[model samples]
Target chain A: MQIQQLSVFVENKPGRLAEITEVLAAANIDIRAISVADTSDFGILRVIVDKPKEAIETLKEHGMTVSLTNVIAVGVSDHPGEFSRAVRLLADTGFDMEYMYAFISRDKGRAYVIIRTNNGQKAAETLQENGFDILSPETIYNM
Target chain B: MERYYQPEVECASREQILAWQNERLVKQVRHVWDNVPYYRKKMEEKGLTPQDIQGVNDLKKLPFLTKDDLREAYPYGLLARPLADCVRIQSTSGTTGRRVVAFYTQHDIDLWEDCCARAIVAAGGTREDVCHVCYGYGLFTGGPGLNGGSHKVGCLTLPMSSGNTERQIQFLIDLEATILCCTPSYAAYLAESIHERGLRDKIKLKAGIFGAEAWTEEMRQNIQEKLGIKAYDIYGLTETSGPGVSFECSAQTGMHINEDHFIAEIIDPETGEVLPDGEKGELVFTSITKEAFPLLRYRTRDICVLNREPCPCGRTHVKMSKPMGRSDDMLVIKGVNVFPSQIETVLLNLGMDPNYQMIVERKNNLDTLEVQVEVNETLFSDTVRNLEKIEKTIAGALQSVLGIGAKVTLMEPKSIQRSEGKAKRVIDKRNLF
Candidate 1:
């Protein structure tokens, strides 16, 4: 199964992230990994948490605008050529990455890149068929 | 703003307004009988003429010119003057079919601007203030009308039009604009933008006179809090005169019609029976002093109540409650009449943000309604079960208020698409045509 991500829309103001974090803390939803994609008007607080559905619900209950997205987390050899080769695989497969970011694995020798493509199911099938390592919810949770 | 048009014949008392309206009503009746053949014929059919009308009290005797009349006349049949004599024309595009257009002479434009100037004054605008007109320009009548009024008031004006958020902010900072003129929806957008940009400290805007669309009190408070300004409501239509027919005075309870220039009447929309003041009904306006396109008792179809109580602002003009949903804005879904304002009232009563979207669709010949509400961060929790419960609660609220079941979809804050002009609240996909 694809990993569910939470994209929380927050006004670009100070302590907004802290406020969101406090709500999650109280809810006991552990944030696995989070990154912020910001624009001038507002910022998208993209979060990968242990419990995506629960996190989304809690955030919604707190009056936050959040959406759940299915993304493929690709495990790659922590090398420059490997990353380039994986991107080429996506390009050759006709799948465009809407957004992506790298997260370090616990071993530190291997790296994981979380990718959100326009078509998640097709991209997942294509990447799987191409022998590329597309992550599962269990793999991401363990990492 | 108030200084812009201290009526050339300012009547400070209610008695004066009645006297002025009575005189104008007599003259307008006679003028309609003489010039406008359509009004003359209609009045003659009703066994009424200039001789049958006495004064303002006799206004009820005149038959109202409904929008159907405007449509029947089409382009120029309503004009009381020659085409060459008319200086301006304003129109509102209807979602149903052809746009409604009204013409005006130079004197008419001046009088309209004077009414706008009265609005500016009522909102505490001054000659030294800077007015930023954000209402749409061109055929929309709001921008240019407010622009003319600001100039007449001697306020340094920024005719910014609408939707250049960055440039509008820049002007507000550089020019220290004190008054804002725009639709309430756009004002909310600007306020949201200013808050996001953290420019609230730099923006000098103190008062906003918003119109051209219907808005709720919750929206008013939200805009007020975000912009640090007192938000005022103005009511008008291109069919009458733009932006200045009635405006919220300092009291902020209701809008005071420039009763001296226009006669206001409440009439039962169904039976065409004129209702007494203080009763809720369709508002009708008769342009008393207008020369070119003086509408004799035009039915505006704006539903609101009238109050003749004296305002603290020392004006005796009859005040109108901010017009509720337009007669045309009413949505007939599954044979049930619904107004978006009713949903707004429910949302506000629930302590939820008024930002909502109504999706209407037809499936298997049955109407389906979905209301997507943005989750307020203050009320959300990080749990799946709780979010579903909140969604159900919202659905329950919707069902109770609307008397029709709606599938409630919880949306992320700022995710429903903020509108800068008219808030797109409905998506009617019934294909009923």
Candidate 2:
């Protein structure tokens, strides 16, 4: 299962992140998870949103440089060793992770991690085979 | 005291100048018809002959020659005189296409020198003064042209050419050179050097004859103030003989065209219709007295106005205003016309927003063009390598339209500024005029 992620090009300047958030807020798009890959010049803002397709349109309308990426989400038991287990599963299979970020789920004793690996479909299959929950795009977006 | 090299001809009456032009235009047309077959064929295409063009009024019927015509002819197509009879050749510092090589006979040199002499005298040069000629020599016409003019005016001339700034200042002081000749930029450079050495008191430059590049009135005043001399502007092209075609006299309103040697006309660049005096248009020159290479109705591409307004300098030659700008906004980058509107068309055709910035830089003495377009979804990809591929596609598309490769950079949206009106599309760091 593949999840939709929005990657925005953000210039390194004051209040740029705030401007992006304001645009999503005005369009009633809630950001579910966010990570910033930053350099001295600019940053790549990867975000998971409640409504990704709508968030993309609204952010683009506000003249933001944004693109889509297909990533896989895997759920693990909300414990210290559970976070390590999911990444070690992909690592042992030699599936390189391009980028990965995690967030706690509201459901009791569970957590979700978004991973952009070299192969999204294959990585999802590998995680599911390893007794981890491969979350679908609908489940991730509705989270 | 005001002095003129040839007072009688320089201050001739309107009728006298008109008669001279009519006779010369008639003779020059016949000369081109009988000798320059390239131009003869053009005249034949128009169903015209030497007998058809009687005076300057009939001059419009002849087809205009452009830089393309000169390049098409290449090294020898436009020569009117045989190589044996031609004594020398001078060329433009052409950054585009084939360099224009103009052949000159001994007599042609004399007349050209005489034109330069008029400019020197207009700048208050005299036999008692030592004139410094710093314009580059060899192929380029500036140094040689002014050097010959200074000699003709009987000024003890120093053919310094350009560069070697310390030596230039040395000669300026030791020789007490009264007249300076070079490009305005080089003049400013010399002034800066002179100031750094703190030898302004030792220098004795009275007037400067600066040309071969466009300059501002403010630059003129600045150089004049720095060097403690009255600076004058001169204009000419190798195609019409160098830096004495027109010169700003002491009157300083505009430059007086040497109408006796060349016929100048301002015409609509697009329609080729000649505009009346005082209307801004493309300047076209017809070399009437040139014996070795007589070009008729040659387009100069410099947009300026001609006025017959009486000059207090008493030189009756019609004056031309300083060049305003080019007739078109096309930029010659690496010898190709890069029009911004054409880039817009290319981007529009590719189904993308044309909001972009064009950067011109000079590297290794060569011009480079770079286009940075704002990234849109259509051109963006998650992978950095894929984004580079998208940039290559834009560069390839621009090359297809511009005939020259441009470095393309993908910028974030809204990275380029867009004012309320007339967005600046180019950032030129070349320092070219």
Show model 2 residue runs off by greater than 4 Å: A1-21, A32-54, A57-65, A69-143, B5-16, B67-77, B82-110, B126-144, B147-179, B185-204, B268-281, B330-433
Best by DockQ: 2
Q: iRMS of every model, one decimal?
A: 8.3, 2.3
Per-prediction DockQ comes to 0.12, 0.39
Q: What docking class should model 2 receive?
A: acceptable
Candidate 2 structure quality by residue, lDDT tens digits, B179-231: 99987777887887788788889989999998776666877887998899999
lDDT of each: 0.79, 0.86
- With candidate 2 superimposed using the best TM-score fit, by how many Å does residue B377's alpha carbon deviate from the native? 5.6
What CA RMSD would you report for each candidate? 13.3, 6.8
lDDT of 1 at B132: 93
The parts of candidate 1 lying over 4 Å away from their true place are A1-143, B1-4, B7-11, B328-433
lDDT tens digits by residue: candidate 2, A1-143: 89899999876689899988889999998778888876554567889998998998998888888988999888899877887888888899999988888888899998888899999999999889889999988887887
